[model samples]
Target: MTDLLFQAFIAAGGTAGFCIIFRVPLREIPICAIIGAAGWILYNVVLLTGDDNKVFATFLAAALVGLLSEIAARIFKEPTTLFTVPGVLSLVPGFHIFKAMEAVMDNNMDSSESWVTITFKLAAAIALGLLAIGAIFNAAHAIFNKTKHVTTDMMGTLKNMTTPPGKK
Candidate 1:
């Protein structure tokens, strides 16, 4: 769809601009742009496929972005946040959040509640999707690196295994 492609292009450009502001390494800006575009295109396509399921569409898009972030982080040796922060900028419903706050100040309780509900649903969808993917990737990374509970305070089980029985 022309609209989808156009939106994707804009998303990519926006991501690049954010990356610049974030001081992301210049060499990786293009990759982050592509990731943002891909996520947006996927989100748009999901929305077009059925009833207006903004939550599900956002969830899928965030999942896609997380997957890309994991892959890019592994390949580029950069933190996933480096790519994810800018990549997700396109999906945030900024206008809705603004409207919700404005409605609250205007004493429009019904409108404020509606907007708040919608914004929370969308945000939860995105957060859950990213959380799911991140947990999986963390598990995989720990396994590959042989670091038991790498992110926890517990000591590495594999590190003990590697040390000799007589070693301190």
Candidate 2:
């Protein structure tokens, strides 16, 4: 139990290194770290629950990361990509990818195929989660812009209607 806690901090520490390398702003570093750590922790939590659906776990974790990135972006007036690019790095399965390639070189087709499938599932989850959030962001932005335009147009129409044609 204690070791698991340690690992979570390690994950966050590693994420901090990524933030540094990515040149994330000092003020926003904490937010990036939080998003990364939360994702790492959430992934483990799902596994620990014995659900065994790593793809779903990754999906949930990435979705949280995207949602948090959007929130942070709004708060700091920064781009979501700024935080998400590095934040997602923490979730990548580097060891799995390495082993997958190693299995391929050893001519172990079964192992290689299994590893590749796992990698694909994890990657797809991350991609889809980000996509889902992106769709939400676009929809919200469009709605807000449309509403603003309609409100302004309505005000202008009301003004014109109240003014007599003779006055023009």
Please tell me which predicted candidate would have the highest lDDT against the true structure: 1
In model 2, the runs with Cα more than 4 Å from the true position are 147-168
Cα displacement (angstroms), candidate 1, residue 93, comes to 1.5
Q: Write the per-residue lDDT of candidate 1 for residues 1-168, one digit (tens) a residue.
A: 789889988999999999999999999999999999988899999988889999899999999999999999989999999989998888888988999999999999999999999999989988988999999998987788786432323564444453356646
Show model 1 residue runs off by greater than 4 Å: 149-168
Every model's Cα RMSD, please?
A: 4.0, 6.8
TM-score of 1: 0.86
lDDT tens readout by residue for model 2, 69-136: 89889989999999888777777878779989999999999999999889888898999888899899
Model 2 accuracy (lDDT, Cα): 0.84
